[model samples]
Target: MAEETKVATGYDTKVEGEIKTDAWTTDGEIVEIIAQDPVTAESEYTEMEYRRLRWKIDLWLLPLMWFCYGTQQADKTSVSVQAVFGISQDTHLVGQQFSWLTTIFYLSYLVSEAPANYLMQKFNMGRFLGICMLFWGVVVLCIGFAKNWATLMALRALQGMFECTISPAFLMITGSWYTSREHTLRSIIWGTSNAGMSVITGLINYAVGQHAERHPGGLAPWKGISFFLGGLTIFLAVLAFCILGTPRDVRWLSDREKRMAVARTMANQTGSDRYKRSEWKWNQVITAFKDPQTYFFFFTTVANSIPNGGVTTFGNLVYESFGFTSLETLLKGTVPQNAVSIIWFLFVGIVTLKKPNLRFTFMVVSLLPAFTGMLALALLPKSGLLWARWGLYLMTVTGNLPGLMIWTMLPSNVAGRTKKSVTATVLFIAYCTGNACGAQVFQAKDAPRYIPGLIACAILFGVEAAMMVLWRAYYLIQNKRRAKKIAELGMSEEESRRQGLLNAEDDMTDFENIHFVYKV
Candidate 1:
């Protein structure tokens, strides 16, 4: 006897999607799902609707990630505050060596970034990064125990090696979990977390410095700050272990939700389920290096990081010049971050909608304000108006300019997981390039008037803007060529739709043999 078909609950083809087939749904109903075989129990995977993601997955996940990476960024940069409260006196720290303590992290990070990302491809991402988090937390705690410059520098290097993977790891996780619409907002949330860290750094400095003065025979407040933060980071790392960083790894998701999620991503990457369980390959690594988008993001980050280096490392000094007391200077410095972070984030989202292709334009335009502000500082004689410097501080939010497009653009064009990982790794290397050079600019003697350094940053940012323009044009041309090729082939409309512009097959064709194309 033919049994009555079971209706699949919560498996609306509009939302969960189906394979286009007359097959038994999860509840055993025979329907034309978007799956491959009409008679089998296969899933009909389709793209995820960006307008329909539940808040639990996208919203909650973003904040937790923001907190994790923000803490890391802020705590690592807090050494500037330590340098202020006589940490140099305590350790007899000096030039270059003092600089190395901060800069060496970038070296370790660059060295570790590619391999760490490679590992994420092979291992369970949450546990892998969570373990790295715990290791770095220990190193940060050990910073409190440093008795000399040598010890502090060593720990910073170790900290860098461990943290190398944190940002890229989070980005990779976010890319894997969220749809294209959610990625921009999530990236901003993650970027904004760094702003949160800046705010905390100022507060921590005040709190720790107070402890050192009032409490006797205890660890210095900065030391206490380092240890406390390290402890906090470890606790958060534990929380990370509980969450599946990748959607594919999440057991909590039902087969219905899993199919919906998988369908959305696979549609973007390739047109089938071939990649559902594929492992790493050597060609995947080489493919990432070959991508042009990888290099565009790289140049943009390098440009952006130079400014980040100067502003972040020497923001304290900029405040000090305005003649505030030590704590007051930090307090004042913290004030700008509150405004700049909000501005950077909201500006990116709001402006992107108006001019989707205008990201690079805005990035280049953003540098002008700070550059002009520096000119104002240099040319305008020092008067009672420290207002210009305060404005200059606000203007440095130019660091966010290229960033608006960096992560978003990668996912927009690339679909393969390996390619995304490779793009992120290369992008961060550019980020580290800027950070490494920027760290060197805050030389001890250059304080109060780091004019030379600021001027150099302005020049580099200009160079980045130029590169961005060229890169944007280059991609546009590549896209047009691909489009023309598709039309010249005289393929049917459906065939053209299926194969895209260049007929480039996404790396995962083993599961379902089909031709695909890169979209312009």
Candidate 2:
């Protein structure tokens, strides 16, 4: 093992060793644990012990987050399934009304994101998220009984308000528990749950549709879909409330394990202030907006999500337009498209893990298949390409990759609790905006082929791909400037690492923390 590099100052002492024991001063749990026995804190936990703690965390935490996120995605996307099974006709939806169903959901999502994140910061994140899930599940259940488009709109709005907390909460939690590389890997695991639930929902929709076809008189397939998903969501909400929380709150981890958990995360340089539910900083909020990467995240998210919104909302419709029945569309089109997405996500996760710093490069690479697919859908002969057009549609699922990569960037690149919170809120606003606008692109007037929407999505995909390169360049430049500044200060590598660990405990922003390195 490398020799322990113990750095002592007037304030506190930290050891940069095989098992990091740097405590975030503001995190009472970690500070208390370290203060109880400084000698043991510095010497405790071997590499094997660290790996075992990580495994325990993974065993308990990953599944809850994975399913909660998946449940949210499935609940939201149920509207798309409903659209095909007569929710539109029964609810008297006409022209753009069907599109407005999706638009309003996101509009509500856009408005509620900031407040939801605020509540998360002020309360127990796990409990706040669970309650949000519970209420959204109720809202989803209420949607089953809606008799008109207006009623569905109201329920969808409530659902949006309740469901907006999951992403930001998960991002903050992942950042608190894991180091930079582990954050990327775990983010991908849960992020891919969106597609994973897509597959599950496709199968469920197929079964529900099939059941409806046979009965011909019982519960409407769409309503049945909502009822089942809503119930599943409530069940997951209970799990989230009981099991999902930060290292400080979870009862599953013993005291030693909790200290080790926080210790392991010091390498990230991002503060643990989120776990404390600390006070907000307006300056950090302003810094989040001022950061160039903030706008890059915004523009890139909007560009990528525009196509995502259109494709997801109109996916089954697009498949049906390609000469298949609703059941066939669910089975062959939705399942396979999402299956391709799962494959892409796993492939991206493995590559990023094995070959670090390739995220932006893969971001560009991932968009190519989607861009090419959109171009084909726009320019190719609309009539009778049959399976060829379907293949192109499947390629569009890769568009989800850029969005996933963007989330990974947040935990690894952004620092400071309030800054991370504000940035996540802004990022989701872009997400909601793009999705709302995206739903409108696939107008009834552009049905069957939706050539204009296809063309617009193609253009947006190109814009997103170019933005990925620019964003990567910005991160690289920022990292270089910070590295040069640290070198000029005559800080040795060990000193630089020590300073970063110390800065993280003070809840410093990435800009204020000179030793904070931006991960590309």
Candidate number with greatest lDDT: 2
Question: What is the lDDT for 291 in model 2?
Answer: 81
Tell me the whole-model lDDT of each prediction, alpha carbons only: 0.64, 0.83
lDDT by residue (351-434, candidate 1, tens digit) is 665545565566667767766665556555554567666667666665554664566666556655566677778887887777
Give a tens-digit lDDT track for model 2, residues 250-297. Answer: 778777787888767767878653237468899888888778888988
Which residue pairs show collisions in model 2?
A: none
Each candidate structure's TM-score, on Cα atoms with residue i matched to residue i, is 0.83, 0.93
lDDT of 1 at 474: 73
What residue runs in model 1 are displaced by over 4 Å at the alpha carbon? 1-52, 216-218, 270-278, 350-356, 382-384, 492-494, 500-520
Error of 2 at 484 (Å): 1.7
Q: Against the true structure, what is every candidate's RMSD?
A: 7.3, 4.4
Q: How does residue 193 of candidate 1 score in lDDT?
A: 74
